[model samples]
Target: MGNIICSHSLSPLSHSTARCHYLVPTSAYDVFINHRGKDTKQFLASSLYDNLQNRGFRVFLDKSSLRVGQYVPEAITCAIRRAAVHIVILSPNYAESEWCLDELYLLIQTGAPIVPVFWKVRPSEDRMEDENGVYAKDFRKHKKAGKFSTETLEKWRNALRWVSLVEGFISEG
Candidate 1:
């Protein structure tokens, strides 16, 4: 190949090794579906998981493996860590659930690529608030109860903002 532009400095690759620096993709479960259990589990998430599984992907879905006595949250965390790619189905009620937010925070922390699929919502309206666009109203409810830490709440907020900005697939339903 001829001289290619250096992605970092916007210069030519004739004398740079930048072009040779390739990122190694993460390995493990081929895909992880992060979605609200009640909102999309029976529909969107399941359909996506089914499609991917049919195509020979090692998919991880929280609903399928939840344990009764064991720590479910920890199990979910482990699944996220083992997933190569994540498909986050962003539904209207996504940000409300504490468990969902926790899973999302972990996904963000992983720094792995996430496929944010908008369901019944758009970026213009994907706002994490208590009484506004895309209301994560549960945050307000949980905050009042004082069950979750301030740091965890903040982390969920930040993660929501990041996910909202990520460009991904969208659906009318």
Candidate 2:
């Protein structure tokens, strides 16, 4: 709604290809990419980011867009909240990382339309692997580790279950 500002619009960023570590969007974004860093960061996330940017879509990708900051989670939260749509890539390990789950939950909570992409999980192997997938294993780990609260875990579980039911893309090879 407001003016667009990012590495391209800001100082130092406007001066060169050199980008700032700032992750918060100065203007509304067209797309926000949510993915497991190890799972799809290199291939799917990178490619989609490039393609979307090339098509003149304002995008927020943490690895490329975020400026140097001690709190990465804060930046991620900021980007997720302002984006127009979310490209959520659900990989095998998506549930393993607390951050990824947090992002997914935020995407759901933000009321943005999510485009779910199953990274490596075959649809035949597991239904809803892309939408919801088998996150129970990692969830159990979190529970056993005494890391996440009951309310937080429930939110993640509900998000996954809800996302699985949404009409989304299924990447199957």
RMSD of each: 12.3, 9.1
Q: Evaluated with TM-score, which candidate comes out highest?
A: 2
In the range 1-173, model 2's lDDT, one tens digit per residue, is 11111212211111111122354535458899988888788888999999999999999888888766435555566677778899888778887777776677767766878887766654322233443445666777877987667776776777676776666677742
**What is candidate 1's lDDT per residue for 1-173, written digit by digit as tens?**
21211122311112222322221123547788998888999989888888998999988887765557535544555666668898888888886776677677777777889989989877655556336566456667767877666776676777777888998999977
lDDT of prediction 2 = 0.67
* Candidate 2 ranges with C-alpha deviation above 4 Å: 1-26, 122-134
Q: Report, for every candidate in turn, its global Cα lDDT versus the true structure.
A: 0.68, 0.67
Error of 1 at 64 (Å): 2.8
For candidate 2, which ten residues in a row score worst on lDDT?
9-18
